[model samples]
Target: MKSPKASSVTIALILLLITGWLLWSSAAAAEETPYIRGAALIDTHGCLACHSGNLMGAMKVPPLRGCELPEEEFQAWVLYGCPQAQPGRAQQSRFGMPAYEGHLDPEDVQDILAWSQIAGHEVPDQAALSDLARGEQVALKAGCFDCHGPLGQGGIKNTGSFTGAIPGFSGEQFKHLCDDGDPAAIEEWIRHGTSERFLSGEPLAGLGRSFMSSQLTKMPAYQDILSDEEIELLVRYCLHINSLGPMSAERYEAHRAALASSKMEVTGQEDSLAGPSLPREVAELFSSKCIRCHGPKKQKSDYRMDTAAAAFQSGDIADFLEVSVIQPGAPRESLLYQFVSATEEDSLNEVFPMPPSEDERLSPEELKVIRDWIASGAPWSDKQTLQSAYSD
Candidate 1:
């Protein structure tokens, strides 16, 4: 009813407002899409708990700060755990990823995928070729960091019924193992895997084959898993770390001296009716079963049971031992006892039982030793012996 110019202006203004609203709505949706959905999915599924450095038994959970994986592979891993995608691949930690097959909906999987891609993309790609940097990248991609730590500083990896302390690459022992300047021996060891004990002239002993074969997680054969180039990179990385000087050189030397001075003394006679004193027996038990993860090189959960002082003073270890790990005069209430006694079925819905893997669980006799040790006040008398043994 108004003039044509006035009507046209009103129509144009309406169109402009509508267009602005649509554009703003689209932008808002785009901004919120990936991160919002992905973060929610990750949180709800408890992915952060494992990936963000929570201890699952003795294993040090690799930080997921810079995780990168193919979309389909990531999805499969999240939904089915490790066995489905890589059948014989060693589990990442004592408590490996739980299969979210029935738990996560299809949309939930998609959201998780979106989150992984977004989070991964946020981290800059490693492009440096320096020995240290390149070596780290190689180790990270090869899953060495899962057991060896992000900096190759060493950690623990379950090997059969016991745990093995992975030596830090930057240590004198590791340097000696690598044959100083030559990395060929290390390369060969990687290529052939653990089957052949010696590589070139270097002895590649220590990892017990019988024990390895009996466990669900074993050192993987790089010949099958990694390319020649990858192995070479790892060797180079090890060499570079060795060149950087040993971690705590002074401490290492002092420890070496102590070991040299200490005389080999038997704890108890072979046929002694009374088992070794609680301290000696517990020391042996810890050395054989616990030190790998809680020793000097790797202190998963900041708990170190290798030495008396470390066990009693490192982080909350003392409290945990007193309360959860060892309850004086009450083995049944002890979390350590409970964990060791847990069956495969008990761990299905939650984290896997202590030692985590079925094959690595303590034997009935071993369990009894632990129970008796706890019931007897968990005394720690032979501190000097443990300190001397674990000096390295």
Candidate 2:
């Protein structure tokens, strides 16, 4: 899968590992200041992609920050794609609020709303050591892992891509996506979802789009999804993770576990990073409750949380859907818990809570079992689940 220019890519990765990438403690990161995750979400989802990055309206998309409507009315329009304009405005425009109804949970309405009230806030201009954590969340929330491979290590197959796979966040392969670690280049891909220069420039001589057309899985445009600040954080994250060199998928997960353990040490959360162990008490609970759908016996949608390794291996329906099935210590962050915890009306994109039926839904005690399990590091007993049962 390597390009002929492998040597050049290797040299670049070595340089990055030696001097460019620095993983520092959270305190060191705070020195760079922080932007709200809301703002970060704004960027990754490309909220400002069409309109001017300055929050000034462009083409026909209205200015995101200067609506004169009452707060309640504006908030309503935001949650329900801002299709309603007043006496002076046209009903149809090239771009308005992207549909948030089924895509982003209702809770996100507030974070996005809070960002709208602020002027010119973006993910910090300078990189934050703290970006490590938030960037991962951004990537996960944006579904980078689904296309790039788990944790952005980049091994997912792409039928017609040059390397025949999506590139990892880091490594020589990323040069196709970003040139010489240039921030603008990375930002171009993030905000526009494709680099105009790369597609039409001397390098590919206009074949970039052609090649992309034949690919089975392609990068989605974030113009409507992410905002500018979110793009920068993800860009920094890609550069930093690239310092790890090209790792096989197994090595990547081992590295991830090590990182998780280190995170626990830094935060002093004893159970935040899970290990491969499940209390015997809860093992049967999964067997009785979850396995009917997500167990080894009959994996629904190719997902089974039956094994510890399987739990972390992953799940995702789409962007804004919970990318991490079990986010270790964050029960609410985990899609598994989110699904089981939802009420009937909380359905996303028509996706209902677990059991998909009123009769079989977990009891409150049963709900607490998984929720507390997730909060307590979501320990599971097993190892080495494949990314999927049928495919590599």
Candidate 3:
């Protein structure tokens, strides 16, 4: 028989092995949480405060929800800066959230997206199952592709020539877009349906040629074609496919710092505030939809919708800002407008069309008010009218 000390040592070794095995098993299970789970973890981390799930960005924070980007491209986005996020400036690290590098593992990032389909949310398992294709077919049937490109990639650049609309995605890609959740912008696109939509803040309009305002002719209402849920799911898929680039931690930090400096710089130099000319109805609209993102200087999205004048020239408005799946003027029609206008119960998109998948869209009266404003050419009323209308 073995000595008592040897027996004790052997027993200890067996217990240690068991403990190690259990830990390894647990880690494996955690790692396998999948894309949706990983995304949920991110949600739990409070990323939604700044980064939306719908990929529709706000003034301060851009969208990140169902962004459709490849892993390599997405990795770069997470790590570097480009026109998609910003040029020269770093990734945004100052937007009410923490840097995810130390807090999340790369595998965890993958899992967040994998588990994204829970709660019956749409998550396409195959690339062939693209809602963009379906949307493209609809766009073609609607004569949207005549200028917008084969996929809704063509858009108008600032120089007055037509260019490609923003890219589209396979079904799986839509998930990332919804995760960012900039539904207000989405609603604006749907309601206003104009080339001047996103122009108030962006500069890309400078590179384009012809605009597509004439294409705003009536077509089959989306309500007649796709279910609201189907349309929203498509939107989410597009964002996920488009946002497949990596996020750069270093660039994000740099941009965060720059944003801080830009704020300081603007504050010290500005003493000559412009005289107010905003109307009451428009003013109320601004207060409700424009202020949260654009009120402060160094406005988010590089565009400020706060003042009609400031936003009027911003290229992204006309070119396309975050919001509707379709860029306003091109082959891309504002689905936001289409879904919000629906009067039937089945009209509700996968989620409500505004605020977010997590939030409610405007009431019918409010939507009708906005729709009327857009239909009447969306003139910028003066401050007096705006104040009088919204004061109650």
Candidate 4:
């Protein structure tokens, strides 16, 4: 009944309203909230007391913050609690978070997730710049690569041959098999149980025990250090690896080209004073040279020169030795340095100079780097820094 001009104007008004509403809804959804609310809620419920303020579950409790639990599994855990809560049992769940169903509503669970996400405590962001590198480190620390091949490419499958059995899966083939597989499924298998589908009926005798026995069985349970979300991110990393396969060659080419172009930029940066300062270089040198012999390998003569990990393992790097060496924060107190730097009389007397006679002494530059690095808090830099810088 309205004139054409009037109808067009009405339609325009309706479209404008729709657009405005959509924008507003999107902005609201994207809004950032303070992590304090979530942190407080966790604290309010005594969850922090058991789970720790950071939500890194206690000794008896599995880590919850970084877990990759699927929504349904998470729901099941909260609602029913674990079917078996006793220790030393095969149990319905590997961890003990005590089902929250009767005590906390579904809304409460959602709020918990929301709180966790805000605190940068939830499963780490898949889009995070460090996700892949961090995931790789987790995989290594967890020994995922021992069975799954480097970079989760999976292990070689053998069908048998005139030359016995050969590694059946190349890195590419392994990537293909694991692509897009549910992280939750892997977690379920790891935590709950695994199937026989791994290597099928292949009789790989020389390969030693099957993947099932070698890995799923032997690997130490990490319900302590890792969380559900972290596992999810790892699975996501598996997918990312698979995705890289189809275009891997092209990507490699592009990478090479970029490296070629950036050579000057890279060289310039390395020359810049901002390059890994003295302390880092020194720490790295120590890790490479001294740690191998004096540290964990033998701790020869009770002198373990291993990384800070050694010190962390013993709490007092001094206790393992006949005398105290490091004062932490202050390298001046670190006897390890003085021993290495010992000029005849300063040597730990009867204690053989580290690395002994056969082993090489630290290069002058190496020693300086080690000294500086030790004094600088012994920071272990991200893995890719040195490699990427030189590659560029």
Candidate 4 residues lying further than 4 Å off, grouped into runs, are: 1-280, 295-297, 303-307, 312-317, 320-324, 347-351, 381-392
Task: Summarize candidate 2's per-residue lDDT along 22-65 as a digit string, tens digits.
Answer: 43122122110011334456677777676465545344566665
In model 1, where do residues sit more than 4 Å from their true spots?
A: 1-124, 159-163, 172-182, 195-216, 245-392
- Please write out the lDDT profile of model 3 over residues 89-156, one tens digit for every residue: 54554544334544565566555443322222222233323343343334445443333222222221
Candidate numbers sorted by lDDT from highest down:
2, 1, 4, 3
Q: What does candidate 4 score on TM? A: 0.23
Better of 2 and 3 by TM-score: 2
Model 2 misplacement above 4 A: 1-129, 248-392
Among all candidates shown, the one with the greatest TM-score = 2
Best by lDDT: 2
Arrange candidates by TM-score, highest first: which order? 2, 1, 4, 3
Candidate 1 lDDT tens digits, 132-160: 34445667787775655334445444444
> What shift in Å separates residue 97 of candidate 4 from its native position after superposition?
72
Q: After superposition, how far is residue 45 of candidate 2 from its true place, in Å?
A: 40
Candidate 3, poorest ten consecutive residues by summed lDDT: 167-176
Tell me model 3's lDDT, rounded to 2 decimals.
0.39
Taking all chains together, the TM-score of candidate 2 against the true structure is 0.32
Q: Candidate 1 or 3, higher TM-score?
A: 1
Candidates 1 and 2 compared: the better one by lDDT is: 2
Model 2 Cα shift for residue 374 (angstroms): 32
Which ten contiguous residues of candidate 4 have the minimum total lDDT? 383-392
Residue 82, model 3: lDDT of 30
Model 1 residue pairs with clashes: none
